[model samples]
Target: MADRDLRDCFLNTLHGKAVDKVPVLSVTQTGTVELMKKSGAAWPEAHFDAEKMADLALSAHTIAGLEAVRYPFCLTVLSEALGCRVNPGR
Candidate 1:
């Protein structure tokens, strides 16, 4: 069977559909120092900027050869939104 699209592969797997292969996904922060330099989608800024975050997440698939992408580089966003002080370390 042919491989499904990346999104479909992920969804199908969740729904217990038969897929040719399960997608290798990070499901969280997938960035690495190496991936940052290679894809030019580094951290710090990417964590805050939606565009940069998307770019960095996509790099997991495009550059790191992962089958899927996930977003929000860190958990600080939730804490910040809940009025918890966030440091956003440099």
Candidate 2:
């Protein structure tokens, strides 16, 4: 095979477009107190406040190279929006 053809084939295999090799899965999730402790990140004082919560989340990705970052780390996000009080259970 030509070098160009081989390179394309390799790329396809890596992306699972071709079925030559079994693909390695890369997936992860958050929400572990131990992880925060290891990284020395402080939990938010008030999960009800959007800005403070965002800061706490950004610190995780910035410090540990997280794969993905999404909003409302606290479960109270929906409750807060619905005008319900969030205790945060800190």
Computed on alpha carbons, the lDDT of every model, listed in order, comes to 0.79, 0.52
Candidate 1 local Cα displacement, residue 32, angstroms: 1.1
Model 2 clash pairs?
A: none
**Which 10 consecutive residues of model 2 have the lowest summed lDDT?**
20-29
Model 2 TM-score?
0.44
Candidate 1 stretches greater than 4 Å from native: 1-4
Of the candidates shown, which would achieve the greatest lDDT relative to the real structure? 1
List candidate 2 segments past 4 Å from native.
1-31, 34-41, 46-52
**Clashes by residue pair, model 1:** none
* Per-residue C-alpha lDDT of model 1 across residues 1-90, encoded as one tens digit per residue: 223577788788999999887878776668888888877767788887777888888888888778867778777778988999887777
Say which candidate scores most in TM-score. 1
Residue-wise C-alpha lDDT for candidate 2, range 1-90, written one tens digit per residue: 443554565577767696443322223334346545654444664244556556556545554444335455655667888999776665
